[model samples]
Target: MKEDIENTSDSLKETRNVFIGAKVTPTQKEHIKSLAGQCGMTVSDYILSRAYNFKPKARLTKEEAALLQNLDDCRSDLVKYISALHGMSTKQRMVMFN
Candidate 1:
């Protein structure tokens, strides 16, 4: 009977809620609940939305930011090298990257 009801609902494109269990610290639970309340969503809804559209938060430490800046400099240097050798044949470009 439950399966028949589920099939009928699926045919109608109606949705039902599903639940899963997760373990987290009390503080984490409180935070999620607070944020979800602000958006008028349940914690589960907020978490599912976040999982579906994950965007990384900026978490750069000072040292990590400096390292990224150094890598950016290296990327700029490589671009300049490639442009300077515009007339170098494809083979030369491949060799330069290698």
Candidate 2:
């Protein structure tokens, strides 16, 4: 894990002297910019990633992220409750206990 992190940091800092260029219309430029923004990436990074045969994941909106967190919390709670229930005997789970 540490090695992976170091490699990623090194790659991020790698300098590029070469230039890649393409001509696109105004509408295409706007669309590409919008896509890059959704993925939380700069235009160059976005274009470079696509060139590398991979798509960058779009960033989640605040509400979407919050909902995912809430669902994860609920799933954790459910797991705990299920494990506790599984530890109980059928008699112990009776609803009409004296």
TM-score of each: 0.38, 0.68
Model 2 per-residue lDDT tens digits across residues 14-91: 676789889999999999999999999999989977865678999999999999999999999999988987898888
For candidate 2, the TM-score is: 0.68
Candidate 1 off by > 4 Å? 1-14, 54-98
Itemize residue pairs with steric clashes in candidate 2. none
> How well is each residue in 11-98 modelled by candidate 1, as lDDT tens digits?
9997646767899999999988877776667777678667656432435667988999999999999999868799799898899889
Question: Candidate 2: what lDDT?
Answer: 0.88
The segments of candidate 2 whose C-alpha lies over 4 angstroms from its true place after superposition are 1-14, 96-98
Residue 53, model 1: lDDT of 69
Error of 2 at 48 (Å): 1.2
* Clash number by candidate, in order: 0, 0
Q: What are the lDDT scores of the predictions, listed in order? A: 0.77, 0.88
